[model samples]
Target: MINWLQHAPVYPIVVPLIAGAAMLLLADKHRILRASISVLAALAQLAAAITLLALAAGAGDIWPKGVGVYLLGDWAAPFGIVLAVDRLSAVMLTLTAVLGVASLFYSLARWDRLGVHFHSLFQFLLMGLNGAFLTGDLFNLFVFFEILLAASYGLILHGSGVARVSAGLQYIAVNLVASFLLLISIALIYGVTGTLNLADLAVRAGTLGGTDRLLFEIGAAVLGVAFLVKAGAWPMNFWLVRGYSSASAPVAAIFSIMTKVGIYALLRIGSLLLPTGAPAAFSLEWMFVIGMATLIFGAIGLLATQQLDQLVSYCVIVSAGTLLTALGMPGVRLTGPALFYLVSSVLTTGAFFMLVELVERTQTFGANVLAVTLDLFDLDDPESPNRSDDVVGVAIPAAMAFLGLAFVSCALLVTGLPPLSGFVAKFSLLSAAVAEANASMQPADAWILVAGVLVAGLAGIIAFGRAGMRIFWGNDERTTPRLRVLEAGPVSILLLLCVALAAGAGPVSAYLDAAARSLDDPSLYIDAVLSASPTRAIGGH
Candidate 1:
């Protein structure tokens, strides 16, 4: 047990990889076996992730320094086959696992049967996500990225509808281009520095001068562009909304974290290897510019969109932009709050994705068309009395009440309204911006950051309000949608978790502040990875 705990960082990648392959070998007819295997693997991964987070948080006896590295012993294995665990990776691992458990359980309700190998593909996807987070080298980073992207392709097109297929194809095309850019950037970095390891690159990158620095900076900029595309920054993220909105609900829910994959890479690589000043190739100012553009673009998209799914998807873009913009603000201690906002926004967007599907189940097709037509034509007279068949404060069925409340909860989360995690998160970010303005933060930049967040929240409120009125309060006669425990249970768990996050913001904020500080200074990670011997496991360090 001690030995296993000592090497726990490897379990997240290995367990899922083994389970996914094993399920693939089992004939497709054995749904029970597949589900059982997948569930156990996911559970094991979650447990391992929690343990690592414990270690990172200074919780367990196995590691005193809250860092661990697992290296492959096989003679044939490349030096790059290394897994490193620290506070940042641990947070992402736990988040991916949490999302995995919820989304997997939700899919088991019915979506798992929609396409072949769902259980296997789902497990494989988890493997990729975990691997991406745990790997210590840029080359392996690309490998794990491709693994996840491939799995996502199948998952996105799982339902096989025309809209889904078309969107998936475009998503694939855009990612393929991004992957090419990533490859080129990797090659450029390797050719110049002769090492793909992040720690080694961090050291060498800092020492480079003259033409070498120019090449490295250009490579980093290209790499940033690649990640920005994945992060769903404007102009490059045209594929995000269409693809995500068309996917199955569970798929979309899990995909809420997909954008963060790029964000994570940027945080890791940019802080470690890329220089951030104005003279450098990839400056923070550029990140802020792109982020604000993406934020404003998403805000407009929220108002322009009529569909619930699309509205939720635009919220994702807004969240990404908000994070990017926050990250760009190094003058302020906004990273901690930005991290808080990331967790809140990701969880809420995921819940929103799942809830939208259930609530839309109550909406009629003709009613939606009628509403759109009325809005476009202005057929109704202004100031005319409007009647709602849905009586105010009337008792609704348990299932419908669940949907309504869940919808409202999701709305609050999206809009950053009071008494929920979203409000707390946005408030924290705004406070950071305002509080730091008198210090290192430029007055104009702080104001823009605050404005950006407020505009996003306002847009969400308007969009969700319009959507809520149309779906829940529409005049068309509606019946309670059929509800399943598996379906509703996941939504409840996520919302409850959000509530808990708010309740426990003090502790959570402390932990995330630690993470932000660690990110602000990459030397801790550099020393931890470089000091470890490849032949032996590094623990308690």
Candidate 2:
């Protein structure tokens, strides 16, 4: 049992799964109890992640295949599902835990007001996220994705306002189509490869020739489409803005992590499931183009929107687009920066979403009083100084100013602005793209990276400008006060996280670089999987 505990990476997956269920059952009617358990569970997961990362970082040879593949109930690998915690999955699981804890903290005060089942749904959502990142089998990845989508369905529409419900339906509809296609893609891959274990599939894929290659590549493309859709890339991201705009702040904050999950899956499978001599050099380029397009589209949409939440939602789309564009660059080269940008974007965007909620509540005033005082600012009045009375509020002015700072920071990060980590990440990708071009002596790839950066930057500026104006300047009418400490505390903490990421980019960069290197060497992962004796079974890292 001790040997199994040491070899098995199952704790990462099991911790969340068990915590989620226990949170639901044990919370009872006391909101404080639920919040305490939820926060503790999330921290426990984070602690475990820190330990796992420390262990991996310390050892030269941590993973061994047989031991890493912990079969549930002591079943063998081929018949039973396995959880693979390669470097990529490990980083992502830790990310989920961090973001999950933040979101739960953000929701503590609002949980009771949100509805009876809000806490449960949120935990379940985390469960799905952790599981998806850790699963070794393709089929189980699909299952985890579905679980996430299902939990999001409830969380997204938790308040169930007319607009929220309508948008949630559209969001679910689009994903349903993509989900079906994803399952079909998996079935095709399983039929062709005769196995679903990612490591085994990677080894076996090399033996295929002719028709088999065609079938696999096509299957890969189909699966790629599903991930692209989830990532909110161009041509399929129309629903992202609407859904995010409608959901409550905490829901939207957590939902931002979902697109990153899609990006992670694409990278994980692209590295592990494809043959080394995989067909088509342009697929990555295609991903880059889609990201560029998303950046432009999101910017345009943000420029047109006046609402605080909607603007933030579109900005998220722009960030996701840029991240995906970076991923589409060729080679094992962009791995470090891509992961860096992804982590930064997730943290920054989550903070911005929370801030938007706070601003919206504080900026708007009571409708009843405003209606009574309408005559004072009536434009038709002969003696009126209406223009002078149009200020939004003191809190809003201060919040908007900070929000603008946040957006500029986001722009700097996303556009690879100088001295910021975003620039560091973009620099890495551009350099790789340039190297790939020089090796092939083709100027087109370099041109693609340049053009993509320009378009994404433009979009970031336009979107932030539009959103900033509405959040700071716009005042159509007044509404009831909704200020709550739980809400502000989370936003403040998230903003601190963003600041920490930017300020400590060097150490952060090293950790991500190490992660990328580990990802490139999958033998370590295989060893981890196979290290355990048969007596102990595992499911995920």
Candidate 3:
């Protein structure tokens, strides 16, 4: 048992890989069986992820130094692919699993049957995510990234509509370019450092000072830009709103985590190679600028959007901008809160994406067009009552009531308002910013971030108000929407998670702080990966 337990780092990747392969072989006709297997696999992945998270945080005594590196085929690092797990990777794995469970179960209602091999594609996507999180080798990071991208290609285009196809093609083209850029940067780094292992790169990062450093910095800049593009930063996010909004609800839900994956890569690589007090690889100031641009653009887009799904996509952009803005700060002080915000925003956005589909069912297409026309002409909705109806109105149906409440919950989350995790997250971020400002932070930088956060929150309020009025209040002549248990259940679970996060903010913040502390001390990670035992060294050394 101890021997097998030592290999826990690989389980997150292996479980989904095997599951996907099995589903591929089962023939697309057996959807129920495939869904059953997918759920089982998702549950198992969640279990493994939680266990890994616990182990990384030193909950148990079995190799609980907070970092574990598994050398593939019992070969040591800098030679072959290595799977490493620490607090950050473990948390990411856990988040992906939770999102996967929600997305897959929701798909069981209809999205999976819309296309062939959906279960397989879904499982493969999870496999790719797990692999990307666990890989300790740079080259293999690219490998796992491609794996995930390939799966996402199928997922984004699952419904096969004209919009979905166009958006999917754009998504595919952008990522392929990013992947090529990643390869170029990797090659440049390898040429200079002669190593591809992340730990090894960190070790060598400080030693370069001359032309090598220049080349490396260039490489790092290219790498950062590629990921920022993937992160849906401004200019790069032109396709994001359309792509995400066009995708099926489940696909869009799972895709909420995809941009985070790109941001995660940047965080991981940056923290490793440029730890606190280390030489800077990419300028935090430029990163902040990128974030600010994205945040402002997304806010404007939010106000301009009439569609709920499009608004949700802009919310995603704002969330990314928030994360990037926070990450632009030096030190681990604000990173903890950034991580917290990531979890809160992702859960809410995923729920909102799925909820858009449900809410749209109640309103008619003509009503939406009319609402747009009213806005263009600056005219009031004729059916809208001019005064308050103190008496009584048409009784709200259960489905509409559910949809309205869910929409409000999502709005509260996106707007960083009270009674949800989003409020807590934003407050934490602001508190951290103030604390940082008290200690040598530039006034301009601090205020910019502060203003960005506030304005973004305000944008959420305006956007949600506009969308809500159009969907719920503006059109009273609509039919009652149908709500399937599976469809409704996933969104409920996701939002409930937000509530739970708010309730458990204390412990969750503590965990995230520990994660930040570990990151602040990258030497711990480097030491573990280097000291890990291997049955045979490279070339049988």
Best by lDDT: 3
- Residues 357-465 of candidate 2: C-alpha lDDT, one tens digit per residue: 6555535442333233344335235454432222222233344455456656655654456656566666666676677677765567556665766666666666666
TM-score of each: 0.91, 0.83, 0.92
Per-model CA lDDT versus the true structure? 0.83, 0.68, 0.85
- CA RMSD (A), model 2: 7.5
lDDT per residue as tens, model 1, 1-541: 2566767888998898999999989885577789889988989998999999988887755555666766656211234466778888998999899889888888776577667799888988899999989888999999999999999999998864577899999999999999999999999989888888888788777777889878887888788889899999988999999999989899999999999999988888777754433224356788888889999999999999989999999999999999999888764399889888998888888888888777776767634633443343332436422222221123335988899899999999988998999999999999998887767535788789899989988988999899888888884777566667778888899999899999999999998898888877777777777776654343323
Mind giving the per-residue lDDT tens digits that candidate 3 earns over 1-541? 2566677899988888998899888964475788899999999999999999998888767656799888888877777678999989999999999999999988776567666788888988998889988999888888988999999999998865477799889989989998999999899989988998999899887888889888888887788877888899988888799889988899999999999988888888888877522334355777778889898999999889888889999999999998988998888889999999999999999999999877876778734642443344333534443211211123334988899899999999999999999999999999898888888547677678889999989988988998888778888777686567878899999999999999999999999999999888888888989887785543333
Error of 1 at 491 (Å): 0.7
Clash tally for model 1: 0
Q: Candidate 3: list runs displaced more than 4 Å.
A: 275-281, 366-397, 535-541
How well does candidate 3 match the true structure in TM-score terms? 0.92
Cα lDDT for residue 225, model 1?
Answer: 87
> What's the number of clashes in each of the models?
0, 21, 0
Model 1, residue 397: C-alpha shift (Å): 5.7
Decoy 1 TM-score against native: 0.91
Q: Positional deviation of 152 in candidate 3, in angstroms?
A: 0.5
